[model samples]
Target chain A: MSESNEEKKDEIQLIFGDKRLDGRRFDELRNIKIEAGILKRADGSCYLEMGKNIVVAAVYGPREVHPRHLQNPSKAVIRYRYNMAPFSVEERKRPGPDRRSVEISKVSREALEAVIMKELFPRSGIDIFVEVLQADAGSRTACLNAASVALVDAGVPMKGMITSVAVAKADGVMVLDPMKEEDNYGEADIPFAFLIRGGKIESIALLQMDGRVTKDELREAFKLAKKGAMEIYKLQKEAIMKKYISESVENG
Target chain B: MRPIVLPGDLVATNPKVAGFGTYVENGKVYSKILGLLDKTETSVRIIPLKGRYIPSVGDVVIGIVREVSANGWNVDIYSPYQAFLPLSENPEFKPNKKPNEVLSIGDAIIAKVLNIDPKMKVTLTMKDKVCRSIRFGRIVFINPARVPRVIGKKGSMVKLLKSELGIQIIVGQNGLIWISGDRKKVSIGEEAIYVIEEEAHTDGLTDRITEFIKRRKSDVGIE
Candidate 1:
């Protein structure tokens, strides 16, 4: 084997010391923590942490759309943005949206378009801002998850909460919730989001893939991703209710 | 505590009329958003916990004048779009002076929402009101969501404060509160309002506020 190839193999091995890194089973997801209503200025806001990834999302509007031309006469428009902090990654990322972030932002809006009740407010806009403070592997998924919670927190009418999880094929096994190490060395990575209602997948909001996998592996990956996303769906509800219900009971 | 319902939660059926924040489908009433379920004798609706103020006709709002134009004065009503207050609509407004002379930027006004255009431009009117401008009084801003509770059912909470403290209070639907009257009473009114805003969602809040005002009235010796 070439020397660099040998070194890369060793590094991958070191990162995944056990059969699975972080002592998690291949299908196990990382610990997720979610908090809503963290920002006083924002209409609604949430802070989300998934393993090492940290993201905050704020929702504004369903208010008037500025720049009058962007106004949709029949439905509210979405101004969705995804931004990464300079210190979010291993190497400091630039503070603004890059190619990856732009793509994520576009897809994130598209994903939200499915969840938000656009017909309710015509000629208005709902702006969602997702700011990543720290990034591990599934930062995009984490942001999507956090933004969904923020949308709910902002009291935007929706069909259901959206949850996202990444599935990857590492070695010969398909795994759920890939961390940074697995993300870099995995054979194939599939990130998908589901709008969940009552333990059922209402719809797939986002589906994106990188690398190669068999058709069978693709289906299995989606199944695993859906299962992982369901867990996140529960967490999202818990986070919202933790803020909403408690405030009512304690203060109302 | 009212049971909270999320979007798509089955709330009721044909017997119960679906109200605001709820929709009916296939003989079932489902919540279209996340909020506390409030049921009345003939209807069921959900009261949202947090959100931007979606302007509607007849909502009394507090607005800041943002721009004075030849036709109308543009006001920021704490909503996404700027609400337009026409100089023609205000009975007291005089075209005899420039728009700025009538209402300048940074001046607050207690106005009512006259109409909302399909384009989402809110048209405000200050006509037919005893007080037009919020002059020489303190305006306290709170979450618009809590405004309804602060006023209480049928304005009982606000009425109690007004009678007890002998103050002029205007509660705006957009979460802007105008307090006036005697100088000492205004301060006491402000504190009582702050208390109401803080504990808007608390149970027995009206009684608690009454007790608070009673204590404050005793301390301040306001007759």
Candidate 2:
């Protein structure tokens, strides 16, 4: 099991100067686009494209809390469903929520709860559904971005938005926003989500470790992930603003 | 259509009063929401164009009865929390009758927000004519954010839909729309509401919507 990753790592270090498969720099990321309010029926919706990964997210509720017992008497309960389409990857994924999907959904819900004012709505549920339509890697991070956009579009009063990025260690190199190949061969894969607070991030909403890593590597990865997430965050905000503020203003 | 600002983006660089959506950080005022920057000589704020309905005191909302309790009824007001309608608030309410008898589950009523407690429990009063039961017509839901567009500048767009098409419409602030009329005309009204929902972000939408409605009505062989 470990031998294959080691072999792939050696070959990666020997051939690629930058440790990225598509000739991107170690810190470089793929193109990102976020479209707000795309779904016609959903209360709030967003479509986010990151590199080769496309994720669509929709938000409904603050509506009725179904399954009467799940209702929280003091705050709005958040529910999340993260799914990958059957054709989202190389192998056709099965059509239901698997263990991985369930875990991501739970984690994403917790991360989002930090930004939302749950106390404002009592005994209700706000549901977030994020579907990964296409995946190359970093589906969870893409899902997080799309979900945050959808929440804002739904007009959920959030303290601030959350943005995420994946950082990996390929051999001795620290990389940001790793693609599929880098993720498989990397020594460590850490995904980080930061809460945008007071115009700066002072806290982490979600953190996960997938492989073996040391202390220094974790620190460097955290620093790099923060930088990467900020870049993505700026674009997300711009996309939302453009959707609401700009006119096609082209008819001069 | 003003300048946009994001969370942590600098909204005020000089000495100024920070308003609702701004917080001072390291000598500069930063926005807390992805909002439009509203600047004045003495004060500045960022008005968020996005978000769900946060019920405040005195807001009129369309509520659907979700649960009936012993003393009052639980109402879904399109907020994350439910609102409570106690028998005491409605002076005309008959107390001995069961809650369902007064307001059945799934009944829609217009109510004034009486109070929002510290825990966010909402109290509603069905004392206004607008807060009465929605007896007839179909309800259409749209994004709460797009309501201003549906209502139009000075109630122009909706009034146009009502007068021209001859339909009764109630524009609920909570994103509930009650459209009442015969089937043919109600269908036309429903289409118009969807049209508004779809292209609400575009500028000069009032004229575009009016033109579309006229063409649609003509196509259907109705004046």
Candidate 3:
């Protein structure tokens, strides 16, 4: 390799190594902002700005599933396409489904399906499309959280509010809502989603760790995830109510 | 201390009693102990937790047409369902002419919900006075949930956006917005919409929007 190429690789590795960010303690989540019902064309849509990461989601359906093969007889099928726009990252991601996108899409669909009352629309499907405008480390979790809020914004009947958080092991400590830097050098990573109303874990998408944790460490991680989810739930509720009440006034 | 339970979860019979405990069943972790409800229960009733717009009958939704149909136009309602505006609903409309002349495919319009079928087919009518085409203004899209914050407590937000920008603005719950006035005022109105969308969850949004308008007005030397 050329000296310049070697230097670039070294720089990338250095940024991902042994450096804590701006004294942000482990288990601390960056500030999150969510706006629901942002798209006029989709049935329900939301925009999520989490620190520097931006994600937009549009939900459609509970309508007829087009392909005869994917149709389910008993309950509504949940289909999700978690995509990153070509301009979303430092290097543009190639458009279309790659392995990472497909995996994230599958896990996200499972997470959301846990809270959605699929029985409500038997023989149909709810289509959720998440478009990442900007991506840092925890895009998957952000997409999950944004898609849940968008689903609610669309008024799709879900059993409860679904919120997701990412936990990572940094310097042998578990932190909730790890930022982009923390994720790269982290020893282990776990992303989880829960139903806000009952606190039931709807899904656990990522659980890769270089080192094993004690049972207590895992429990603490779960606690932190729940706390983060609760905070997101408040924002989601506020966004929904603010729209509903104002629209009511306009109609009145 | 006893564990707190959120609504809409099931609890197990011999549930492990601990705060923030997780139980494994069929390869899934039930995060809260309370979610392990009795399996034999006849009906599991999860509360309808409020989050955002739930499409209902008679809702006035503002949308853009994505496609046209012989019977009606297929409008994107920004919901899980697509709305159909039948030509019959537009008594004055004549078919075979340019859809744009009567109702262009991309034209933003506000219409009322006539029926929501079991199939999630949304039927809309544009016969109402407010349901007609939006003209002499620019339409903006915002999160439907932020409409209240944009409008303020009692028409305060809307009133403020209008007076400060010197424009006429109408907000639709379906996330369609129309702003009409001077060019500068129209741009200011659009900025206000952006601010509302960005900072809707934050407190003091009204002040923020007002300040934005003031900054734009002063920047334009209109004081």
Candidate 4:
């Protein structure tokens, strides 16, 4: 029996007896902490930590646009940049916007643009910067989470709030909030962002997939990711309220 | 009063009208910003907690002259849009005279927002009795959203500050407050204004500020 157990330990064993390598259920998410309005100079800002990933986002504008020609005549334009710190990863990553970051920045900006009331600030621009201070996995989703909170903190009017999460498949089982190791060895990764209103998801603002999965597997992953996102949405709301509520309580 | 509301929170059901900081969707009024909820008999409004100043007609603002154009002066009102103070709106305007002679760059003036067109072009005028250029005074900056609180209900808070401190105060809608008095008195007034800005959301703010100012005056031997 001991010999059989030793043989079962494969080269990369990500699960054991219905539990992921980290002893989390397939549907369970990693620990998350979010704080809003952390930066003073930025119009709005947020600091977020999900699992081992740490991200900070800041928002500026609804202010005058530069270059004189980029101003949108009827609505505000969004300028988004997603960056990773040089010391964030194990292998020292180079500074500045790479191709992957550029693509992520474009998609993330579009996702937030769907919910913002851009027409309110015509001939102006709103800039959002997301900086990843640490990288585990699902950093794009983490960046989106921080950006949404920062927008609200800046008091930029919006049609609704947004929440995001990632689904990972390791050892043929879909999981929520995948760690760095799982992402490296996982079979598939799917990240999603949902527009939330009235305590319900109004629609999907973003959806991107990597690697291959069966149709049924994708549907199952969507369900798991939505459930995880709702939990994150509650935390996001709480983080924003905490700032004002604590002050009121101190004085009231 | 209800709890503070975030964007997309349902504020009222079947409201007849939605006021500022709120919007109507599908016959329901929803808050559009993070703010305190306010409901009237017929409509709903959300008082925004923080935001940049958006120019509206009739609002008196304190602006700095950034450029002296041919026909008008470009004024930085500390808003997203730059305002134009035309030479025609100047009470001292003369025919064929350069605009810079009237008000050169770097001069600060108190003007009224005369017009905001469809494209958000803000126009300012200095023809009102209260409008004038500031030569010397201290300008205190605070969040624009808290300006109403600083003025208090029906200008009572401002009245208290003015009488207690014996200072001339001009509260701008754009959050630039002009205070002029003896050096020590102006500093005390600036401190009091910052206190009001910080505690704007609290109850009985007027009484607390009164006590604070009195204490500060005695501590500094203002008599």
Best by DockQ: 4
Question: What would the DockQ be for model 3?
Answer: 0.09
Q: Across residues A1-252, which tens digit of lDDT does each residue of candidate 2 receive?
A: 233334442355411655466788877878998899899778779999999999999999777688989988888899999999999999899999999999999998999998877776787789999999999878999999999988877766676789999998876678899888778766778999998755578689999988877788788999899889989988888778777665323110
DockQ, per-model, please? 0.52, 0.30, 0.09, 0.56
Per-residue lDDT of candidate 1, residues B71-128 (tens digit): 8889988876679998888876765777787789899998889898776778989875
- Candidate 4, residue A20: CA error in Å? 1.0
Interface RMSD of 1: 2.4
Alpha-carbon RMSD of each model:
3.2, 4.9, 12.0, 3.1
Interface RMSD of 4: 2.3
Q: Which regions of candidate 4 deviate over 4 angstroms?
A: A1-11, A246-252, B95-97
Query: Order of candidates by DockQ, top first?
Result: 4, 1, 2, 3
Candidate 2: residue A184 lDDT (0-100): 76
How many angstroms is residue A129 displaced in model 1 relative to the true structure, after the best TM-score fit? 1.5
Interface RMSD score of each model: 2.4, 4.9, 11.5, 2.3
Q: What is the lDDT of residue A148 in candidate 2?
A: 90
For candidate 4, the clash count comes to: 0
Residue pairs in clash, model 4: none
Quote the RMSD, in angstroms, for model 2. 4.9
